[model samples]
Target: MVLLRTLRGPAYTRILGIGDYRPARIISNEELCRHIDSTDEWIQDRSGIQQRRQATPDESVVDMGTQAARAAMTYADLTGSDIDAVICATITHPYQTPAAAPMIAERLGTKNAAAFDLSAACAGYCYGVAVADDMVRSGRAEHVLVVGVEKLSDYRDLGDRGTAFIFGDGAGAAVIGPSATPGISATTWGSDGSGSAMISQSVSWTEAQERYAPASLDMPGDPARPDATVTDSLWPFIDMQGPSVFRWAATAVAPLCERALAAAGVTAQDIQVFIPHQANTRIVDTLVKKLRLPDHVVIADDITDMANTSAASIPLATAALLRSGRAHPGDLALQIGFGAGLTWAAQVVQLP
Candidate 1:
């Protein structure tokens, strides 16, 4: 065991490049209207998604991730060899065995790059960025690619209004590097296992009812079984409690944003932009009103075009802002990610 020196304060992280990928197939609300009892107006008002891109049945998750990753690398003006590590954040990577990060590494030909995947649900991107930052700051890896790619459409129950209307498919990537004056500042992250039911499905419930019935039920906490699980079904696909999640996000996000800003020694007024998790337009709108942040300081745009891309939301929004020239180097960017750890993570980053 080694005695630690004073806690290193504000280690640098820069967002060197970023990109987002939306598949070519556009599925309109009218398309959903034909299949389900949903109107364009109702869907738009509720989720801010008028249309979303769906991947072709043949498109692989790796293909999508690789496309976004290449564009990000190009934007960063760096080659594969320049990357020291790659962090891929995906909940829909197509396989359970080999992590997609390494596969993405192989595709990008980042042979020397250290790679791994982080499944933090929608908060995965923020978590991945935090991990990559530590690696560079601790002198383990210098340049890292943090990718948030997901294809939630594969698991979505299109017949279920609550789940189907909310999720869309997409990918986003960012290149994070070391800088004395960081593009990223302090981050604040939190989780509540209690709310796990609000966003996940229970696979064990099915197995128990089908495979073992009656007295042999697999309920983790039968008095006979002390080791029974307190909860079940964190697998299969995401099942969300929309109104509850919106309320939680609205109530929870601002304080974490304030906390992240405080940790960075900055104020809301000092922030140049806010790239919050694109969970819902309503939640984003609600928090913007609640925080009293300036019009220039917060960006809640893009839900109309993309829906919630889960972990990919923030980076996609960031890329749009840069593309539109709404942002410039030296701008202060505040990003927050919340969901399915029933968790929230916030970071205050300075943009280059």
Candidate 2:
């Protein structure tokens, strides 16, 4: 019989640094009102969003992710060669074959890092963080780059009022590495497929291609509309059942957060900051009340200016919190992410 030697890692893992990229273009509620029959006041009252960022036509998910990754690496004092793996969490990467991770790694100058993409929808960034934590703890990788990015504007339905004002484009990245003390705690995560339809794409890729078949390809455009094209009909858009999602997020996620706190051996009193996914301001308010957190715990409200960036929300908000000096190194933060797939994940960590 042959015996194999095992590798040992550090005592725990911690997030070394964090960074994010908000698009240069801002789309205010007034501008969105032109396409949908919504008033600026009604939009603000409903979602607590005044404006959101939108990337230009030329910006791709990789471009935004790379910029964010570079910033995180710089904050961690790491170069491209220092990364042992890259995990990109996004559903908006256009290419279905080659994943976005390798492209980002190569662009960052990594010659041979393990790379892959994760599709957990809005729960993706937390999912990536958990996986990276495990990898470092197990000695499978020394340093991991986790990025959450989305370019939802490319698939948005301007005429659909339900989601037109809810989504924005952005990217956020974090570097996870070995630590002397425990910085990341046990994560509590789960999913419910029964509510999967609550949020989803308007059509499948096959359905979109079928709609663009030759028989329907050559239809004449209205004489009054010279800019109309066949490609417009083939693009899939995001769709959601707002009430159902709100109910799930507001009621169900609170208990999940409690479980995460318990798993980390901490209570609401020990946390200094709370960064939930920036899905909506109302949702954040409900969770805060449900958790009964003390007044000193600062809750992230980036939704007012950033809208919902899906997987990028938590880290983006984390970066904003740190930049504002509301959170400092070694401060305890409770982070939770929940969205499509009815998926949810939460954990407690010390701020970088």
Please list the Cα RMSD from the true structure of every candidate, rounded to 1 decimal place: 8.1, 3.3
Model 1 bad stretches (over 4 Å): 1-11, 202-235
For candidate 2, report its TM-score.
0.94
The lDDT values for all models are: 0.76, 0.88
Compose the digit string of candidate 1's lDDT tens values, residues 153-219.
7555454676667777788898888787767776788889988878875344455445433423453
Model 2 worst lDDT run, 10 consecutive residues: 221-230
> Please, what is the TM-score per model?
0.87, 0.94
The per-residue C-alpha lDDT of model 2 at residue 316 equals 91
Model 1 earns a TM-score of 0.87
Report the lDDT tens digits of candidate 2 across residue range 1-352. Answer: 9999887788799999899999998988998786778988999999999998988767899999999999899989999999999999998898887999999999998869999999888899999999999999988999999999998876666667888899988999999999999999999998999998999888887786675434344754312123323233435777899999999898899999999999999999999999999998899999999999999999998888889998898889999999999888789999998999988888898889
Clashing pairs for model 1 are 183-350, 202-233, 203-233, 220-228
